[model samples]
Target: MCPVQLDGIGPLARFSRRSFLRYSAAASVVASVPILTEAHLARAQRNTLPKNIPPGAVRIDANENPLGPCSGACSTISGLIPEGGRYDFDLTEKLEKTFCEMEGFKPGYVMAYAGSSEPLHYTVLAFTSKDRPYVTADPGYEAGMYAAKVNGAKVLMVPLTKDYAHDVKAMVAADPNAGVFYICNPNNPTGTITKYEDIEYAVANKPKGSVVLIDEAYIHFSDASPSFDLVKADKDVIILRTFSKLYGMAGVRCGLAIGRPDLLAKLQLYGMNPLPIMAVAAATTSLQVQELVPQRKKINADIRQETFEWLAASNYKFTPSQTNCFMLDTGRSGKEVLAAMQKKNVYIGRVWPSWPTYVRITVGSHTDMEKFRAAYTDVMNSSTAGLEPMPLPRRLRETPFTHLS
Candidate 1:
């Protein structure tokens, strides 16, 4: 596979004075509406778990990094506990500055949030509307779809190509007035990548006034190139980065939105809460560790490859994933397998409606995968006679974005 280049994208010049003035005017009304975030989405995903989880359960759900924050990040966060009382907004600015300098982007083009989900929601709220539909791949990350629901925008779920890559051309032609085209590179659920040229094609051919939202949450785990070059060229693109996956900071909650200043300003209209101090400190220190990304990438890749090999030897079908997760096809109903695995204390990922027979599996530590394999094999051979799949979440219908327990 051709690797996506990762070299620094050259610095982008600041937006015009007029654009900054306009953004300043719009920033006044901090988002009064409560928006759905990734935490809420995670809760929705967790609805699949049993009422009571026993101790020592092998949990490979949620695609979380088993290796927690690096030593430097832990120390930096620990050292900042005393000053937690004060809202060190300057630390956020410094964090933003550190990331901007590293990525060759102007400081004004980036904004730090608790996690990328905030900006993801804000982007849909800012760009999409009832008439201007939201376009995304079916079985892609569902966070944006929920955000679109909040905005009362119609969602167009284009099916991924036969190869499991985003059908960029179909997405472009899905709706002529699409407000936002969301792409999750190394897509969630299915860890397959849509090519860089296809992304460029979407940028070039997408409807006018529509922005292409690229979620690179799992980019570090994949060999694909980052989309910073589009932002550097002043395109209508916003790229989201997070410390959750590879950096092992999901609970710490630090992420960023990279785009043109004018584009980022639209997100500011949603909200501007100060970031968590510990998250900022940890993220800053993590960025400074130059060797952190490659080292962790190898760890995840090796484990994932080992698991894939086992699945092949056992004649189990799965996507050729390049990241921390992949979709596995259970010969029977995926929900039955999920429930049976849960009984064995080996909880896996949820099932997507588009592919009822396929369940997403997060690549965990080698030991975790070994247990998963044991549980999975036993479940496959045993009869699922009385097993019942977890009930579909009805709370979403009751109230969109309501936290599901």
Candidate 2:
């Protein structure tokens, strides 16, 4: 089928900043904070990110694993590359059943999506409505609110607790009829976790019919999470997983959604995604080789802890992150700091306005961190270069590289 026709879009469906913006603009229902000017955006639009750029620009903005994929997964994808013409049933079934076994989840309770994003977007579209608003933490996962807006559901953005974790009580109090209550554990940008018991308490008392989606996308890299026992017991909760972060399968794109059979079944309304043979092969192999994830998780934790030590010694006020990324208070415009870092070929994450003075940086390799530290020192020391350049985070659609669990 012609994909463009399916989106009711023309030949311009390719992924450039402008095309992506055009398609997403019509669907924005949530009131967004505008910050960038036409002139500023025009520069980014006109720039093609110099092709010969070096790899020194470590990408922490998108929360990607610096490790790309494990050896077995690499082999699997390499095996599948030449077979693009074939259906990927065997590999997909192997993945589904193996994931169920490994995760201690039932195969029936699981469904695979190329990435967690489509399922996130699809799940909201399938269940939410004008009367049943979508409730989430402000500065939490923007994807959920974006999904709710596409469906014309009211978005209630509750503020985070002073400690920077999701205010479970406040979120529960926001909208009783909420169709989807989203909590990103070890919440993004902040890198702090909300206890599993807290989530269970909220889930137990959630609006009688609403679904609680606990995104443990970063859980593998952290300590234990609220277990998948809820999904096993047929509770009204869904857990999302991806092979991106530690397993290094960001580009391979394999993600899973676990919940009660009925709620998982509701996903049928959106129809099945044709699992790419390549992704299926890579993800399935990644799951079978579980040691790789644990090893990488430890590496990420070690790197993160070391960085925290430095932050502490330097008297940097930063959020405590058990995961792979954390926010640092730059004491100034984070956007300008981000740009400054970029100019030095060390792209830290964007400036999150929730703490306008803070900057979020994804935990990169020790080598990358050293470069980042050097770049940061240079930027701070440069005479009269302390001001942050404001950026208008364009209302772009979700990252096309969405399997980012």
Candidate 3:
């Protein structure tokens, strides 16, 4: 990724070195809030009895892998419990090495985190500021927007193309002083893939000293090619990978940020905690399972396609998706449909302001999707007037930019 040189006279320069230091320190503390986790995001979206999620609720809201950790990963986690008292640094090293080998990346090009969100946030904080605006697709993942707001950076939300893919050209033209162009491939909420050519164009044409942050959190669930080759080419790009999706370790929390060592070094300014030993062990074992990705990909794809077909036959409008999640355009306010589904005990995902009528749906297992289909049909067939509007929690409503899938 391109190193953001702070030599010019703008926000980075005007903000004194001492002030920047204080800001970084304060932001680090803020970023550590536990509510930023994936699970908490679902709770924030629903604004219901979050602390007491119903026991038998068919929860397809979070885009979590319903299969959970594989047998091997479970066995690994169980075996590693006794050794959890001490940090297994080698396990972390082994995971990094194995991932690098699997992807043909150099050793220092990767660093592990609890989840990709940390690095994602850090990258935005490191590169963006008032002068250097953050550019992202409209209705895209909002974590980067949250980081941008934290850094006092302007956010330029570019609308996606007609097919719901990232409008790379429009993104490049969004702002000349753009510091980071955030792309979530098999993008969250929509689950649509932006073409590789579009990504390469963004990387090739982005402003000088700017970086393209590509989040591949759901890459495994789709057939689209990854952008790791851009890293190998030493282009200005940082690619994020997470075991939270197909590997089924959302709660376990293990992820990677791949880029040049210099780019990775910039993210360290925000400070990072030591790797969790249990997560490291589980992730290491998960990476070695030969058939895990292919097997899970087929399962998720099958269910997602089936759901799409049902929606099409029922005359419901939806975004055709490649990943485990897709957006459905309710004929009325998305919040009404969300509440209706909640009443039916089939919890779905949140809505983006850009698409007020579209509610995201996470493709769960066969039975979970079936429950979703029934609840969705019932909600769509009924009038939305009687559905109570469940506003987001106070904090989230106050800062609507923090809404992420």
Candidate 4:
């Protein structure tokens, strides 16, 4: 990892003399800085619900692929169980090789992890500090912000554009000495795509030495193009990918961080360990199935669209989402509606503070969504006069369910 250096007009210039010294000291031993731990992964990925949910509940709360892994991946995982005794680091290398070849990325440019959350946290920890703030969209994914908190970095939240896209221009201006500008394409909660031009603008115009981190965890579910060219050009950019979404490997846990070798090396400053061997085999086999991405994309798109159409026809308000999840505006407090839905055995996503009346809903299987439609309609029509809003302190508190937020 490259150490921070003092220059006349460099990134450290914005810091006071004392702050700069502290940041430099922090950077010197960054490898020892603890960030989000194993427990954080679950919170970053989904809003936790009650543990006693019936097994048959329509679980559309977490943005998981109900389709599970493809047949090939399942078979590969099953066949590899006996070999689990060994670390089988070779399997990880093969998986990385398979992905690098397919994506046209140089071998060193991509680092595999158990899930995207680890790299996401590491990237934030490596880039942001007390001197350099972490810039992100309000009501966006909160995992990076959690890392920023640990690093003592100020988290500057730029509100989304009127259409719910990341306000890249606003983000660029949010902190002149920003360390990492994060954009989650087809943004979470809203699931709306920021224009590719806007992303390019952030890259070209961002402060020198600052990295533009793009979390493309939902890219496969949308028609949005990947930002591989930015990494290829050796720009200060990092792209995060995960099998947890469209690959239906949320439980399997395989992901990648793609960027210039120097940029990726910074993330390695935290730590690197052997990935789950079964995850590697499953991811490798999944990649070989030529039809996987498109087929699963279609499945998610179809189900999401069907849900959107129902919401529209029923005159309910919702964002025009292109991914497997979308924000739904409940005429009342979203927290109330979410609880009511849960009572009906339909668990949905949590509400973002910026959009208190908007509850996020993950697109589940056709049958799951059908139940959601019925339960949602019933909840909206029924009385919730005494259903109080989630308290501010509780909403922002660091719980196992909401630590990321």
Candidate 5:
């Protein structure tokens, strides 16, 4: 990875001397031999929610694929039934190899989780302390910040660039105790990508012991490739991955993280769980179809572009995106739009207090986007839209925002 140089102008100049030192420390640890341990997870009883509940309402809320596992993955999952109670390290091993190849990294650099959120939480639990801090883009992903906050770590919130991509220099400058520097590529709500080099600099110039965690959950739909080279080069950086998106396997629970052996070892404080036979079977099958992503990327992109185009023609403002989703600037109360859509049987994504005029919209199938368009039109054009608006509870609201934009 091309490490970011800390001595710079514009944003970096804002980092206090203490903050610069903190960023340096973060970079050192990530670049060093293993020092951090993965924290342990207190296992909870298995979630028994039904797997295939139909979306009765036209739902474009979650960034989930409306259509589920591809035929190859579906068949493999069904085949795993016979060994439902068994543990197959062989299957897991193969899956790891597949993951390594796909990311252009090695097996040792890769680790598995039930979902990307698991590792996201563990990274916080393992690293943050009263003296250390958690730094991330405001109005980005929420799960990581909560983990850090509950762990008693200070949280440093950085604003995004005017264009919506992460302000990498600000993130790097907010160093010192910055335990983990987070960049959610094609960010969660906005779906914008910071240039690969900017992220590289943040990782390279961050505090020596600090870790840079890139949440690439939307990478499949995003045009940018993740920085696995940093892992291959043995730099202290973690790239998170998930099958939850493209594979439609959120219910099955599978995620991966890649970094140098030492950086990954930090997460080892949390012991590994025996592979779920079904998850392994399906994930392996999903990884086998290397071409499946490119094929679907185009289809998803076409749908996303069509929706954005319509929005543009209608004078709706949205964060220009390079992934399967984007944030729509409703030019009014997003909560108002949300309630209106809900009443019309269309529920889009979450709201951000930071951008009260914006609401996130996942790129669903063509028909679902059409449903959202109609509902949105009705809501915006109706008189009831003037009613008082309600927001998501604290947790949901906080996760999707850093500060008012």
Candidate 6:
């Protein structure tokens, strides 16, 4: 799609230096609120897990990398255990420097966090407000919406294009006073990519003072170009990266946010806690492994393709995903399929309200996926009697912005 001209925007165009300062000050106060505490964050993560997940269940949910950290990273973490007592070792600085050099970013263009989630939340809190709305793809990552609600910002959910990519033009037109445009490459749940050109269009034509937040959490799994170059060009964009996916450090919890120094500084007003010593050490070493990304990318792609072939042979419809997860359409209710799979000890993913009949399936190891194929076929062939579709909660069904004013 062609990029549209976004000239003649009024108050949004006047997003001056004074306006930034004022927004940042207000965001800082919101960040200090009790809801953003460390305990709350930890609790949220725990809640994503299914209760009483049985041991040995084929877990293809959560889009987690089955392969843990690389050998080099594991060794580094083991070596750094003794040094954990010291809070101010230069390991975190080393990680930032290494990432900057690797991505050709200038000094201070990147900041490390526990995971990409923290920076993602901070970006929404910093840029969005009641007047300035948060615009995101309808079935996109839900975390940003929650953060926007915390800041009392209007939430605009733009539907994806026919190809399952974010409709950049529609999103730009959704809200003239948009503060943050969140585009998740290889979007969660769907595991599909919004084209890089579309991202550029959104960046260039978005409402003035709006920041384009690209979540590249699954970028390594796909062949799409990284958005880091936009940061190098000093565009009003923030790119989030994490060691959790390809590097397999989800539990280790190391991630980075790349953007202009001024933009990143605004996030700091919310919170910039110290990095864990072991996670820093592991992440630094992981970056040094020359062949780590390509090797794991091949492994994941091959397994995902194999699973796709199986679904096709079984005459089931599925989304073509370049990442480690894909969506499968169950002929019956998705919740019923999920429950049947669980009965057979095969745990898959949650369903998005936008497509209640389709359930997400994370690409697991070869053996785990084989188990999934067996369990899924059995569930689909069985009777769906007495199985009711679970409706989404009212809070999740309605946009948070509607309740405001």
* lDDT (Cα atoms) of all candidates against the true structure: 0.82, 0.70, 0.83, 0.80, 0.72, 0.80
| Cα lDDT over the full model 3 | 0.83
Q: Rank candidates by lDDT, best first.
A: 3, 1, 4, 6, 5, 2
Clashes of each: 2, 5, 0, 0, 38, 0
Tens digits of per-residue lDDT, candidate 4, 1-405, equal 122233333433576676467555646655444444322332332323434447888878778888899999999989989988889878888888888899897778888898898888888888888899899997888768767876778888888888889889888988789999999997986899998889999999999889999999999989887898999999999999998899999889989899988788667646557788999889989889999999988888888888888889999999989999999999888878877776787878877777889988989999999999999888888986665533434324552222112
TM-score of each: 0.88, 0.82, 0.91, 0.87, 0.83, 0.87
The Cα error of candidate 6 at residue 110, in Å, is: 0.4
Error of 1 at 175 (Å): 0.5
**Cα lDDT over the full model 2:** 0.70
Q: Which candidate has the top score in TM-score? A: 3
Q: State in Å the error of residue 35, model 1.
A: 5.1
Model 2 / residue 34 / CA error / Å? 19
Is 3 or 5 the stronger prediction by TM-score?
3
Candidate 3 colliding pairs: none
- What candidate 4 gets wrong by more than 4 Å, as runs, is 1-52, 388-405
Tens-place lDDT per residue, model 2, 1-405, is: 112222344443555666456445523422242222112222331212442235545556667887888889888788778899988577777777887777787657778777676667667765678788887775566667756765768888777777777787877877778788888886876778888887888788889888888887888887757558878878888888777676776666778788876787665435455788888778888778858867988899899888888878878788888888888987766666776776777666655435677777889989988887788888777742554444334553232211100
**What RMSD does each model have against the real structure?**
7.2, 8.5, 5.2, 6.6, 10.4, 7.5
Q: Model 6 over residues 71-171: C-alpha lDDT tens digits?
A: 99999988878888887647888899898898798988989988888889889988998899998887777877877876788888888788889889998
Q: Which should have the higher lDDT, number 2 or number 3?
A: 3
For model 5, what is the alpha-carbon lDDT of residue 67?
69
Q: How close is candidate 2 to the true structure, as a TM-score?
A: 0.82
lDDT of 1 by residue, 1-405 (tens): 011111222213354566556545545322323445534543454434554446898867788898989999999999999999989988998898998898898658888989898889889888998889898897788878866876778888888888999899999998899999999998997999989999999999999999999999999999888899999999999999999999999889999999988888668656667788999889999999999999999999999999999999999999988899999999778877887888788878877767888988989998999999999999999986667655646635443321111
Q: Where in model 6 is the C-alpha error above 4 Å?
A: 1-50, 387-405
